[model samples]
Target: MTSVPTPDPGPGRQSRPAPHDQRSRPVPRPRPPGPADEPFDLLGIGIGPFNLSLAALADGVPGLAAAFYDQRPDFRWHPGLLIDGATLQVPFLADLVTLADPASHWTFLNYLKHRERLFPFYFAERFHVHRAEYDAYCRWVAESLPSTHFGQQADTVRWNAARGLFEVDHTHLDEHGEAEALDRTYARHLVLGIGTEPYVPEPLRPLADAPAVPVVHSAQYTENRERLLAAEHITVIGSGQSGAEVFLDLLRARPAGYERITWLARTPAFAPMEYSKLGLEHFTPDYTRYFHALPEQVRDRLVPQQWQLHKGIDTETITAIHDELYRRTLDGGWPDAVLTPGVSVRTAGRLGSREVELHLEHAEQGTRSRLVTSAVVLATGYRERPLDRLLAPLGPALRTDAAGRPAVDALHRLELDRSVTGRVYVQNAERHTHGVGAPDLGLAAWRSAVILNDLTALLTGEEHYPLPVRTAFTTFGLGGPPPAATGTATRTAALRHG
Candidate 1:
């Protein structure tokens, strides 16, 4: 029942830092008027965690001119999925700037200090913080940062051949998300951290798109939780953590004997996520480097097979679910809940006014059936938001791989034509190139450091953000190590810290 206190709100896009200590002192007022007409060293699109990490790390660097934009009026990470008692998958060390620079002013520890909650957090001994708390911590960082501009939507990007910079057009949005003004900025380098959008399966998209249907994607679960809970019978579809969490939440809300819920998973079983010590190495930089070096075909084949790594319910949540179900069974028979796996929703449609019918196919049993439910929650997960419209102006300069996907190099920079002097880097849009770590919070700080270091070295001869050469105990490939991934200057800086 505890809560973290928020700092005092100041006028527009800025806030007054708490008087926790000298470190909490306001970062100079009026926020530096960043090069209005001149090109910034880097202009990042999307202020999600990945790019937020970049912005935080860049704050500590001396002279890097960078800015981050997002369409949202304020920072909110997966707002709908912030189920009560649901914690982040990764530990707190995976916060905005801790892994890359523990001493950073923007670290979670610093945020805790700023909020005057260090003693509480220390005594609580909680490693993986609640999802809501993580969102609040990020909002704390985003609001305090002068370089991060929310309510700004990047509309188009083009490479200026003569100027050797990237020109970005953005729309300044008001509180209601309407475009208030047109603005433009130029940057020598661009980073896209647009992040992902909730993906409802095609079969269930119709009901979800219907204005009155009691169907929602897990991404918006919290928003529609009340409506869904009031339904006669609710069916939750998905095998990932979101589905598990949503099902668990619904079950807990319903009466003991009349749970009136069905949990359908496409996977063979309600399996636990891979969380073993060594199993987690796949999210380290070592694995990302090894995976990026492999031939494209091999890389493509490996991702789907490794789903349990990045996409499964944690044992804790799974145990909590079982415990709840077990508690219900103690009274008499089982709760009015049906949990089935290896089932796919072939199609779904509204049944007149008060119900929905879903045509389902059981994979292993080779059977088909229909399930009528009053409400549906599709936890089918998310897809990377397409960058086509935003980057269309780049045209031929934006290279692609054999799969027609953007070709991202080992440094996370898009492989573009040699004629274009500017670089376009990606954050979560490079899973095929960077392996599973592309979207992981554990690797967020590290990846940001990598991008910042590379970009800094381009401007100045020195590497600003030092990174360790080896991250994982496992040698990812048959080779001992991928050829030292950093330049000599960068390697030396990392070796000092390694």
Candidate 2:
């Protein structure tokens, strides 16, 4: 890796401003003969935060050649869901490289320092960063990293048995999102960080499809916020953080007594997220290992039972929603809003070109109802983009689980046929195998480090990244020997205890 100068903002000292040219430096675009002639050591499919984390960490490593591709023209993280005052669930330390390599220049602190906001941020003492600021920080890293190539959509990936490498075919899209050219690149290893897509449930799929009633997913909320607010009646579905934020934003925007809004969810209540210190240990690598070791059926059962970990609303958001409703009730009347839980959207259809009717059923009450609304916002969360289309050429080499999902190993590599020598790894696409932590921002850097270390181990027969000794205080299983005992005695003691 090339050596770059590090900026040291000494204790209680702020760094000087970047020069005009340095501040205005444009993102470097890869030239026409992109990685085709000279193959890269690593080639990444999508330039999301997960893969961007890998690129940022890989930058500090020596003799590692890598390139990342994305279909979009630039990096933007959930631009729509970046509601005002919305903060990330995780702290700033969970950036691209801090947890893995704090010394790296790509840290969020460095971004603040470079942008001349270090002192202000220090004074603010904000542990959880605002969503917009986090997006800007990621954009800063994506723009600075020379290895990232935007506007290139990877179409297919195939293993070249003769060359012992993977070939990726891509179409270079113009600013208009039109395909301008086609190209291919070869790499010894491949990493898929294609990320997730907004999911609309089957019952509401048709309404979300039709352009008549202005139905939109929370992923596109910001773009349609004004229209949604102007409607006579608006409904927000799902009980996750996104849904809560969207409902809160709309609630604050509309008049107190005139707010015609309905918030519905399949969950029994607007439950608070599991934010206890020890409860968070489930996101640690140790818990991930234990979860992966369980039987497939057990893993499936535990995921739904742990919904509060990832699916529940943040306490702050829930409080804000209640506070807003309470303040509106001061006028001797409740706000014109309905908040219901344990309700599922059975089906949806257009009442007219300007309105939508939803068939709803309550789980506990065993009752049914219909809601007519001018607009709908579905915040039903995201699903991992399937790799079937892209990996069609290598389909025969892929090993799948009982549910027909790809079997991702502990190192995040897809279980592939023995004949295929090249490795195909995944990011944010292994929740079934690695558990909920697979898509968590806090684990991005750690997973990236693991992938890099595994890659290096394959090449040099030695670990490149230092693995964490231990991450969680809670021991996940009873099969392990007591911490106090040693070696042979520990095994003897375990047998005796048994």
Candidate 3:
């Protein structure tokens, strides 16, 4: 397919600076495109931490040609929820390259050293670094890597059978993300790490969509915090880590005696995440291997039961919220905050120009009530970004499971038709098949190592990243051999369509 280049602006009008960052950089473009162009060895769709890990590891390979693209001006991990002093759920070693290759130049410790803060970090002796610092560490790796391209949105992907390659159509955008030109690139292999998006529940969708209503998702908490805090009363919905963080931030910011905030959750009680030593092993590769080899029905039944593994509140965050709320009652009266569990918001609407009315229901009591507040923050969590739109071109070739989701394998490759020889690998999108650890930060580096190992094995008949024989001390199952590298995966892929 031919790509139409952006016409010159005649040298008079300069494009304005892009959003997110003010620093000016060259307008992003892939190398020249035509029949004569050579396909990249690997092309990544998104530049989130998962893909950033892949890019960082790939940079170490002697002559691998790879590029990762994102629509944003630059890498920023959950900018809205980077609440002050909010630490990562996982330890700092769960950084981009540390778990996979600690000696790599892109390790978090190396980033600290480069910034001249290694001694201070050592003195601090911290395990869980702040989320804002984690964001900075990832940004450091992202910005330093030459293979990552910002401001480029991959539009669609279709296989060019004639070339035996995956063809990606992407758009280069101006400052405001207005498309400047359309271009296409070819890849021998494709890796998609386009991360999740903020989710708003059905009951609160209307208020969230209304322009005047102050119903905001926690994903935008930091950005819209001032507007929310200025109101007379605020209600926070959702009981996940995000909900807890938002509620605590608001509680700390509001004045002591008049702190009018309501925190609601559907859980029986505000619970802590599964952080016990044995429970933590669920995020290990051993458990992931066991989870993937389970029967489809069993796998489906297991994910919802494992919510506490990934969706529960941080124990520390929950404790901090309790402490802050308890501290407010020192003068012999409870602070004006209400924390109710086992309740859900049934419906929500704009009560007035600046307020929202939430209809609440208690699950056990079957009781209904209405809470009209000046503002509402939906601390509701995120959902995986659907791949249907991006994979439509290959719909016929792509195989799906009984529930209609993609049939991903233990190696994380889409179970596609044998006609499509090039593998379409996915990251952080296989929770159904792999288990709760699919999106965990601690697993990001391991997953990338697995991918790189397989990718190089297929290309050079040798693995690029050698993985540990085992990662978990606990035995996940009675007996099942863990997934080997691509040697076994190649054979499994061949039999997938048989």
The stretch of ten residues in a row with the least summed lDDT in candidate 1 is 1-10
What candidate 1 gets wrong by more than 4 Å, as runs, is 1-36, 482-498
Q: Model 3 scores what on Cα lDDT?
A: 0.81
Q: Candidate 1 or 2, higher lDDT?
A: 2
Stretches > 4 Å off in candidate 2: 1-21, 32-36, 481-498
List model 1 lDDT by residue over 332-386, tens digit each.
Answer: 8999999999999999887887788899999999999999889999899988988
Per-residue lDDT of model 3, residues 1-498, tens digit only: 111111111222322223335222334444434435667778888888998899888877766767777888778899999999998999989998888888788888877876678999999999999999999888777666667777777778899998899988888866697887778878888888988988987887888655776678888999999999888999998888999999999999998889999999999888899899999999987788779979999999999998898889988898898899899888889899999999988998887687788899999999999998888888889989988887789999999999999999878899999999998889988999999999998988888888877788788876766666566778777864444454324322322222
Please write out the lDDT profile of model 2 over residues 36-79, one tens digit for every residue.
36677788888889999998887776667777888887789999
Clashing pairs in 1: none
Ranking by TM-score: 2, 1, 3
What are the TM-scores, per candidate, against the unseen true structure? 0.92, 0.92, 0.91
The global C-alpha lDDT for each of the candidates, from Candidate 1 onward, is 0.81, 0.83, 0.81
Candidate 2 vs candidate 3, lDDT winner = 2
Whole-structure CA lDDT of model 2 = 0.83
Candidate 1 structure lDDT: 0.81
Ranking by lDDT: 2, 1, 3
